[model samples]
Target: MSAAGSGPEDLARGVLEGGARSIGRAISEVERDSVTVPAILRRVFPRTGRARIIGITGPPGAGKSTLVQRLAQAYRRAGRRVGIVAVDPSSPFTGGAILGDRIRMSEIYTDPGVFIRSMATRGALGGLARATSDAVDVLDAAGFDPILIETVGVGQDEVDIVRAADTIAVVLVPGLGDDIQAIKAGILEIADVFVVNKAEREGADRAVAELSMMLDLAGHPEWRPPIVKTSAPSGSGVPEAVAALEAHGAHLAASGEGRRRRSLRARSRLLALLETRFRRAIEARAPEPDGLEQAVAAVAERREDPYSAAARLFEELVPPPREAAERRSG
Candidate 1:
C-alpha cells in the first residue's frame, strides 16, 4: 500500500455517510496535516469521476460569485446535489483569508442537496487551497453531482485550476477595456467555456465578439469553447449559461472525453503528491545553521558570487542532480 494508511478510516466513512460534524472535523484535520492526508486518500480514493468539476475564474469584480450562485440553483432544479468550493484570496498583511462567498450563495446553504465550502487560497498558486484536490475527492465520494470551484479572479497564474476541473469557465464583464489583453494568451487558451457577465452593460456584444475572435485565432481543437452572456444579478441569461454548461457535460460523457480528461487530472494529482512528498523530505532534513542567512550576508558584503553560493547551497541541501537520476533509475 506504499506505506499509506496511517490512520483509521472510520472517521472518513462517517463523513461519507453524511455525518456533518465528522466531515467538518476530518476536513480540518486533513487541512492542518494533523493526519497524513495522502495516506488517507490512498485508502479511500476511488475515482468515480462522475462530478463535473467546473472552474470559474475571471478578473476581479467580474460578478463570478453571483454567477456561481445562479449556476448552483440551476443544477439543484435539475435534481443534482451540488458542491461549491469558493477560493478567496489571502490577506497579504495578516497571512489570513478574507473569505466572502457565503454572502453570495446564502440562499442555497440550507438547501438539502447543496454543500458549500469557502477555501482561502492559502498562498497556493492558481488561487486554489492547498488541499483543494483532496477536498474535491471528499465531495466526489460523498456523491456531489456537480462540483464548482470558483477562484479569486486573477490572470494566467490562477488558470492552472484547469488541471483540476473538467470544464473551465473564464468570466469577464461587459464594457471592460482590453478584454483580450487583460486575460492574456496563457489562460485564455485553456478555457472550455467563457462567460461575459453583466450583459446589461454597454459593449456587451463587443466583448463577446472579441473573445470569439480570439478563440478563432487560437484554433482550439476537439471542440471550440462556447461563449455565453449572463447577468446573474437580474437572472438574465442564467438559464442559457446553464444550458451551455449542461451540453458541455453531455459532450464529455459521449465522447469518452470525460474519462480521458479525468485520467489526466488524476495523473496531475499524483505528480503533485510525489512533489509534496519530496518537499516534505527536504524540509525534514533540517537546513544547516544560518545557511540562507550566511549566503545572503555574503552576497550583501560582496564577498562571493551569489550564483556560486546558490549552487553550493543547492548541492549541500538538495539531492544532487545526478543522484536524483540514480534514485529514479534504482
Candidate 2:
C-alpha cells in the first residue's frame, strides 16, 4: 500500500489482512502518535485479545534478546505466528533505538512466520516505549499469536510489563552479583516465571536456589513462580521455560487471574489515553506570550509559585463544573 493515499480504513484493512507492510505502517503511526491513530485503533480493536502476550525483562547482560529468539522459534515449531516487540534503549542524540536487539536476533530475521519490531524507549520510564502497548495491539489485530515483549534490560522500578503481558518471565544470570537482592522489591514480585539464563556457568544452580528461597519466603499461596534454568546459546532448558510460561498462562485462565489482569490493563490504557488527551487539550489552550509561556516566565522570575501558576493555568483551561454547565447550556 502506498503511504501517500492510504487512509486509516485502508491501513486498518491491511492490518486485519495480516499484511506485513500494513502492520509496519500501523505501528509507525502509533509510535508517532499520529492524528489517524484513533480511527485505526477503533477499526482494529475488535481483532485483538487473541494473542497471548509474554513479557521478558531483567537487568543488562541477561541475554534477553537471544532468549526471546529461542522462545519465538519454539512457538513457531508449534505452528504459531509469532510477533516480537523488543524495547531497546534510546540513542541520546537521535532518540532512536540502538537496535542492538535486532542485530542479536538476526538469526530469525528471515523467518516468514515471525514479525519483529524494535522500539526505542524514547525517555519513557518503566522499561518500555510509550507506544509499546499500542504496537502490540496492532500486531495482535494482525493475527499474530503468542506475542513476546522483551523489555529494555530494566532496573528495580521498571516493572510496567506486568500491566502489559499475560505472563511475565524475569530473566536473570548466575553471576549478576546478588541477583535476588537486585530485583527483590519490584521485578521479583512481577514474575510468573524466573529464567536463569546462561545456566552452564558455575553458579547457575546457586542462583536458582536463591530464587527458590525468595519465592518460599514470599509465600505466594495462589501460584509460586517457577524457576527455569536456561542456556540460550546452547538452547538448553528453553523448552522447559516455555513450558513454565504456558503453565502460568493456564493458571491465569483457570484461577481467573487472567480476567483480572485484562481489567487492570484496560484501566491502565484508558488512564494513559486520558492523560495524553488532557495534555494535548492544555497545550492547545496555552499558546505563546500570554498563556502557559507567561505563566512559566512568572514562575521562573519568582513572581508566582509553580503550584499557583499550575492552578491558574488549569482553571483557565478547564472552567469550574457549574461554569462549564452554564456555558454548555448557553
Q: Pick the candidate with the highest TM-score.
A: 2
Cα lDDT tens digits for candidate 1, 73-171? 999989989887766563221123214544545668778687777664455563243466766776776778798887755554566554578888888
Pairs clashing in candidate 1? none
Best by lDDT: 2
- Model 1: weakest 10-residue lDDT segment is 90-99
Residue 249 shift from truth in candidate 2, angstroms? 0.8
Write down the lDDT of every candidate, Cα atoms only. 0.71, 0.81
**RMSD to native, candidate 2:** 3.8
Candidate 2 Cα misplacement greater than 4 A, ranges? 1-5, 90-107, 123-128, 287-290, 323-330
